[model samples]
Target: MTGTETLERPETADKVEHFDVIIVGAGISGIGSAYHLQEQCPDKSFLVLEKFDSFGGTWHMHKYPGVRSDSDLFTFGYRFKPWMSAPIATADEILKYMGEVIDDNDLAPHIRYSHKIEHAAWSSKDKKWTVDVVRLDTGEKRRFTTNFLWMCQGYYNQEQGYTPEWDGMDKYKGQIVHPQTWPEDLDYKGKKVVLIGSGATAATVVPAMADDTEHLTMVQRSPTYFFPGQNANELADLLRAVEVDPMIIHDIVRRVALFQQQEINRRSVEEPEIVKQELLEGVRAFVGPDFDMDKHLTPKYRPWQQRLAFVPDGDLFKCITDGKVSIETDTIECFTETGLKLSSGKEIEADIIITATGFNLSVLGNIPFEVDGKPVNWPETVTYRGMMFTGVPNLLWVFGYFRASWTLRVDLLGDYVCRLLKHMDEMGVKQVTPTIPDSLSDMKVGNWIQEEDFNPNYLVRSMHVMPKAGNHPDWQHTQDYWREKDEIPALDLDTEALVYS
Candidate 1:
């Protein structure tokens, strides 16, 4: 059988479908990538394979109460699409927006739902990828071949969230749940709940379940930074009042928000004290001066070290002030029959415990990848701007920025990948891989990301499995959108580092 031809067997439910490009996942990154490919590389045949039954990856997976976007929709939404709602949006609203994108672009025809990729094998001789897949809805097996593989499946494992085992966890009779897999039938009304986490998920769930629960207490080992403000955008409102184009309003508001974020990030590095004080003072304003900011709200690290979760209109603080939610900054000692005992000897009684700790990091959707019969070892390979990796040909992974809205990099990488594909066509090459030059072979290498730069628990826990970064800019994923915005567009695709065959 020819490499590009579709093969069918009457005896078995197996077939090999070929495409110019095959994108993994149907989430925000994958959908945005698909739109760019269609618009820029009009002649290239492509397909998007989503393991889930529908679109909206994280939004669809997370169903807990008060689930919402931590980043403002103006910046979080795609640049081509206008998010004409409040700055903060619910999962349903985000899904509706994504649905509109699919409908407007006619992308549904190109997407294959419920197709979970099993193994992806690269053929050096054939200069293509042969993918093994299983239909989740059926027991049918399928095969697909593509000239290029675009991994947009996301960075975390969706099957299970990270819930640390504590002493006597099994002895506790109360129900335990993770926000990633929130059960629809979960009734929290009149229940004494203790949520364990200090991240965005905990902040979201506390206010959402506060009123209904007998009492909700947020137990965090350490405090996290938060930015609380009104959900509405004044600039967008002003533009709407004057009847400006919705598209123009979106662009203007997004740019302004980005600019503001850049300023704060800069201060976090250059003048951390000022930024720290500003953040603390903001919290004091919300919780009132009488509240103990240092004991309950202040974080050990500087601002922007971890994500400063956005709390719309200070709702979390409102919950605290209204006596519906309480914050306990201490470590969990052990679980009791009725509740949890803290390291400080304080016991919290609860009927339900929600672990919003975090998620387990995954590499390439935890798919076993083989290159020319040998398994791909990600840690041994070096990343090319955190997209392409060494020894991996005709493949790219979309790993977005931690500090900025994840969609921003999705849009940026979308353009870069399309251009690279076109350049390959021009060069008469079917394979391309990032190669570490001989001169830099002995240079000091480090973890996937620098701890000092950005160290959330998910990335910290999975650093061992991640690809290494080098001292050079070409071999590094800086995670700086401001610098990368200019650097990526100006990148030389024909450099020697990118070996073409």
Candidate 2:
């Protein structure tokens, strides 16, 4: 910070860096956009503006002890790049993979690190968007113009994590930390550690720190669905052993994984008993028959009501069986001098506390957007294919499927944007917007999330900030991958749904 404040900056404060298309992030989505831009639109000039000093958005931000993907790499990894390592990859591996992609694709020249896009204004007369960019160093501001704006910035607040105010939190003398902003130097070796919350983060941290800490405890208000999966995928290993090309292996393995995910998701809702018994039996095998699974594993709601947390090779259960970890399924009444006290009068002693709570969802990078001098009201607008917003011309936001792998939809989006630009060029059109009929105008505005029954805590907290959806499919955002897969690619550009200018 001192060096930043004192050094002379290179990016001129008032200079504008223009491009044909301007992407707002350098995470997985943004990088994929760049790759597709190179592959599909070779002549188009573009720039990727990253807010952080480096790439790997979520992976780079959360540097806690156990930071790995809940979903395996078969689908989470890009279809273009076959993930050949362990099916479940660590944060470091993902970061390295991203860097390799950028290097191999010669995308480093197009990236502007430490550049944040703040606001954008569109002019109908100019038929172009004027954007404001801010440099994190020296607080310099600049302006740029683009014919199209691709919002690849991810859907959560990067700077902060959601931590509810617990009673008597100030009295705890030990160090308290949040996983979003973990300190590199904070040591937990041989120290008692208690992680609060039963979400994916807490599940990940318990097993990761079990061997390092003197004792590890997971505190949860209620139980969440846990799915124990094999760490190594034999299918991938066998495919590689038989000398199948990695890309072909990726194609087959990705589909197999997706189909498996879809089948499990279906049964979780339709045949809950089958999934419940299968999952609990895996736990019971490790924890023994005498263990009280009703208190620690059973949830009142059905499976997939919230996200199903995954632990590879049953690592979390291994920790519990090894006597290195314990569970507290109760509410925290208050924080004592050293640890938290439950409402049931149960006390947990800890030297360090990690709040693996959740995230504050963000829509469109929290940027102020204006078209022809009028502010964009998202809730008043309807979404098109969960990507483009009605009345917003040539602006597409890459929001992937919630239940499926995020990259699956984003890969489609990158190609779709390229195709859209080409189609506009062919038709001599400069702008396009989704148009809804007057009959749908007065339709009841409901939550964008149709499956409210599958409510996660983070989505419940931040759904208000997102756009609304009506009853129609064209007006609503569907979370089904198969439906979107068949429908989006075959969409007609000349249809009445899109108005060209």
Candidate 3:
């Protein structure tokens, strides 16, 4: 057996282990945390515990056909690693990229895969966290303690998939599938498929399935705003000509892409109607006037209020125009043995049903956590700077925003955490937590975004947190690259908002 396999197949559990910091969830955030931590605190004993056998978190778990990043690779990719391949990367490619990152950084030894964290509790007297974990394969339970606990655990559990309750769903004779936990061996060729919901997943899957499936119908409760993916050939060509180190190329491309995205966002904010018109016109041109654009195309909310679905080269609209795909905007009244029954008294038949209904916003996964033996209610605890939660000592959470690439925000948070850890070490502080000022009220804190059709759990929780702009210019929430570089480095680590002891 390989040395790695030997270690993984341990005969007995190592019940008592210690670390300077314990990071949960080995996804992008967690891996990023490890990368930063290793650089900042080389001497510190740190461990990354992932529930799954492999890395790549979300990218690894989601294996549906046509699964790829909605955001362009340049900005969506890690700051340290440049996206040298396609501007829009596929799931498998992204996963491979993640694996390379882990290998390059020598992060394998730090990670213990299949080690699912069950619970974590803080000991006020010990000034440390006692974390309980389980080995899924062996059903072995063990405990470990750490000076700091970092939750890199992403906001969703792929296993606890979301399935909306539609009447008569149980009666359906055909195979029902949720894209989150898609079946491997299911065949779609020559099958009439009905895809439920109108989100990113649905938008992506419909076009992909259209080529093989006899006919694909998208059932929508409400319409989602659509935007064409701008994988700029000009930018791609420029990067190709001036090919430098992959790392440098990645950084340059990331900056350029960030600028482009910011420009789009700026135009949308300044000229909402014009931006809306352009988007609608683009969709109309692709889908053709034969399709009812007014009924099925328009969204209830303004652009960027919720994420606009990205269709690469109008792939989704192309499929629709070619008669391979169709969209139904009526409310799903119930499910039937043959297909879905709409409130309009129309029944559409399908041999297979795919529920791209949406995801459960696991702001924090169901893993139980306590501070000083008191149960911590996540909703009740205010988020600090939208990254860390107030009242939770020595803990940090990284979450992305609706307006920018998730990795951009996550990179910044990772840097900030590294800086914070360094600052804490210098001051010999054992614990740190945000102190939410009494003056800060819900009235002062406005929602960053709102959409009737989009899921609100994560956004709502994040809105109440102090904005980077209001707190300090460095912590201020501009997604611009130059501004972030200038401000983030200059952030006052000893800000009054943070309590150190």
Candidate 4:
């Protein structure tokens, strides 16, 4: 078959099959769960359903220029697989690595592409889930039953990125683009560019565009915390020396890297005044003292209140110093015929306007789940061990945090979930769920996420829901790996969970 043609799988076509476990996403988290589940429960049947045609989730969806990982390969990559490439990985290389992971594990046979999960309903009587799905190619509807449901659908749907309505966007003559849905063929070389938003994407794109664009301006409503990307050459060499022993090498490198990162973070917190002064001094040394450091670099919130934008090898700072890129810290009032009109009544002209705003965090596509016809409200529900939702029996959700590599956290969670499943099987328990007692009162927990951070249009229309940080000790706080292994490994797998007679 040619590259563009879809090969027909007549043997596995248009049929519904049941499994012991059903994983909803084919992304890194979902793939990690599938890998662990297959290893733990080789005797049981399991399947992974991917909404898109390919394996890589976000990497496959985003194809803009300078697309790459924000974190270093040592920490961002899979523990089992040694990142043999440079310290930082390009998007194409990352996608290729993801493909290799899926193929090397022989996971292709168990995956069904173009299958989007629509909704899932649980039956208390049977202690199983009946999931409804749609086949994107043939427009066929189907259903499958599974004993356990794992939602690794990730935090955002690529179909929608956060795009706010600008007052006069329609009147603008220049081409408007959202980085998430970047057009592949659109040419930008030698064009005057204006990139909106001060997040990671903007940080990566501004410097990349400066290489060819006539001029580039990064417009931000507020400042985002920036940090120099500390991808070390020594770490890569060390990993190469111990490549044969992946686990030991991963542990060693991860520990050292985490230590360095935490030390930097600690200094920022413990010696704020000194660190701030040092940072300001560095900025002045890079740019002139006349440069507006407060307007461009000073963040209103504390460091890591959100994620800090990483600049690989000081590329962003270099671009600013070279006068190739400029930062404009003003509220965008509206879109003009030629470019953007700021609140200060000043106009910035551009041939192309790219919106790199952010993303909408969706916990399992905000799908309304029903167990025995009783609807489950997820935001009101507490997260159990930060993996499973309260009252959602036999269901597990995997999510990463702003502090660590998404895959690393999810990998640990996946292993813990598999262990839980194994313990359940040994105990002959059929279903498990967290029961919140009335005696305990709920309180606001972490400020990792806030309502203002999310786009109302996207959240209300799409599948976007935030899980509550649990009120109890078991449910509250995300303490890194050691604490997680202790709590989750000893969790009451044999609790008052249901068992078939």
Which numbered prediction scores highest in TM-score against the true structure? 1
What candidate 2 gets wrong by more than 4 Å, as runs, is 1-12
TM-score of each: 0.97, 0.95, 0.90, 0.88
> Model 3, 290: alpha-carbon shift in Å?
2.7
Q: How much is the lDDT of residue 151 in candidate 2?
A: 93
Instruction: Give the clash total for candidate 1.
Output: 0
> Please, what are the lDDT tens digits per residue for candidate 1 over residues 1-501?
122333332122456899999999999999999999999999999999999999999998889998999999998999999989999999999999999999999999999999998788899999999988888899688889999999999999999999999999999999999999999999999999999998999889999999999999999999999888899999999999999999999999999999999999999999999999988887788889888788888998888889989999999999999999999999999999999999999999999999999999998898878788777888888899999999999999999988999999999999999999999999899999899988788867889888887889888988998999998988989989999999999999988889999
lDDT of 2 at 285: 79
Local distance difference test, each candidate: 0.91, 0.85, 0.76, 0.74
Candidate 4 local lDDT, 207-279, one digit each (tens) = 7779899889999988776766444557657667755466666667777876776765666667766666665
- Deviation from truth (RMSD, Å), model 1: 3.7
Residue lDDT tens for model 3, 1-501: 111221121233566798999988888778878888887778889999999898888888887889988877777777877677767778988888788889998999999989987777777778898888888878998788998888887876568567778899889999998898888898999999999988888888998899999999999877888887554546656757876566766766677777777777777778878888888988988987777887898876667666778888889988988999999998989999999999999999999999887776565666667787576666555556556666788888776655667777667877787788888889988888777555543324333233342334334544443222233322223334445656666778787778888
What's model 4's overall lDDT? Answer: 0.74
Residue 288, candidate 3: alpha-carbon lDDT = 76
**Model 1 lDDT at residue 317:** 95
Model 1 weakest lDDT span, ten residues long: 1-10
Clashing pairs in 3: 82-250, 468-475, 468-476, 469-476, 469-477
